[model samples]
Target: MTAPTLRGAAAFVQQVRAAEQHLSGADPVMAAVIERHGPCTLGATRRDPFHTLCASIISQQLSSKAADTIQARLMAGIGAGRRITPPLLLAASHEELRGYGLSTAKARWLRALGEAAAAGTLDFRALGRLDDEAAIAVLDALPGIGRWTAEMFLMFALNRIDLFAMDDVGLRRGVAMLYNRGRPLSDARTLKITRRWAPYRTIASWYLWRVADPVNEIWV
Candidate 1:
């Protein structure tokens, strides 16, 4: 199936409100979170999939500020006249990429992703035509892309409405706080609890992340 049609901000806000209403009816615990958090700011920011994936790789095990610093350096190194295309990335040397603060493993992964793009093995344009599971599978097949990273692509890039990153520490913590009385939920329990939020779980996940760490901005 093709991806869901992208909506403008106004339309998306209305959609989120509707989802919240549905969630409130389905789960009282989550309802209280919505009530307390007021409105969610889970708007999608469209990005080139390749670049976004590369950014995801760059962000692994790093803080948001550090990731931002590395990404800025990478963009500068790629130069102003050129776009951050797969070919440009493929042409960049390990030394150059490492200079931008990329670890050897990450630099290798980025290059491999670039090669896949150049060879048409990973087509960004066709991603929207895939179902969520298929899209996640495709992304997860990449060298450095894991299930969590792929789920993130679905949430932030394709704006998929139903995905839940069950392994995410923050989401688990938030679930524990809201439902388990401030103790972290086991992965199995988290999965079962999140089932009720289906179709709007992405929105629910956003709120959970917020509740887990209200002070820190989650960039990944």
Candidate 2:
């Protein structure tokens, strides 16, 4: 099987800078966000498709810190010098998976993913050729993955530029804080604001994540 092409971390940063230049020119509100945050520092991890999907599954509806802990525990149990593959998860009983702090639903999803992988139903490589919406549809069809999770997979996993997930609470909060004085916008209004960030919305979304950070000082 051909390995998925992975970019060096530097390449992703270069893309961010390029995106920032466009964003700065296109939207002043976003320009302020860029000025405050400086460069986009969204790290590019070279995780394989299955591993990335597994992490995404683990992260669903959970806070980042909690999700990381659960993912770490499960990975540790998979043993040293081993990758997460179909059989490894297929061999894991649901009870064993739950012991790693996965909810019953998440554990079932993981096993379902394993089953799909083993059956050659979910072809990670094939996803590379599909357009964003198409790829998202395929992933969304999977038992537990939702539109938000699929959007995240495209943004973080595949590193597709220009993806925006309006339903994400953080992105919504970021949009509200920046453009609406911390008042939430309806999805339609939010979409209007995000449209100007297009073709670089992924990078824009990265800054939104920063703008919505509670620890960051309020924007003037």
TM per prediction: 0.88, 0.88
For residue 77, give model 1's deviation from the true position in Å.
1.5
Tens digits of lDDT, candidate 2, 1-220: 1222544556666777899999999999889889987877554445567877888889888877898789888988765234578788888899999999999999999999999999989987788678889999999999889999888778776777788897888889999998889998998999899999988998898889887874642111
Residue 70 in model 2: lDDT: 91
Residue pairs in steric clash, candidate 2? none
The deviation in Å at residue 42 for candidate 1 is: 2.3
lDDT of 1 by residue, 186-217 (tens): 77888899999987999999899888888876
Tell me how many clashing residue pairs each candidate has: 0, 0
For candidate 1, which ten residues in a row score worst on lDDT?
1-10
Off by over 4 Å in 2: 1-13, 80-83, 214-220
For candidate 2, give the lDDT: 0.81
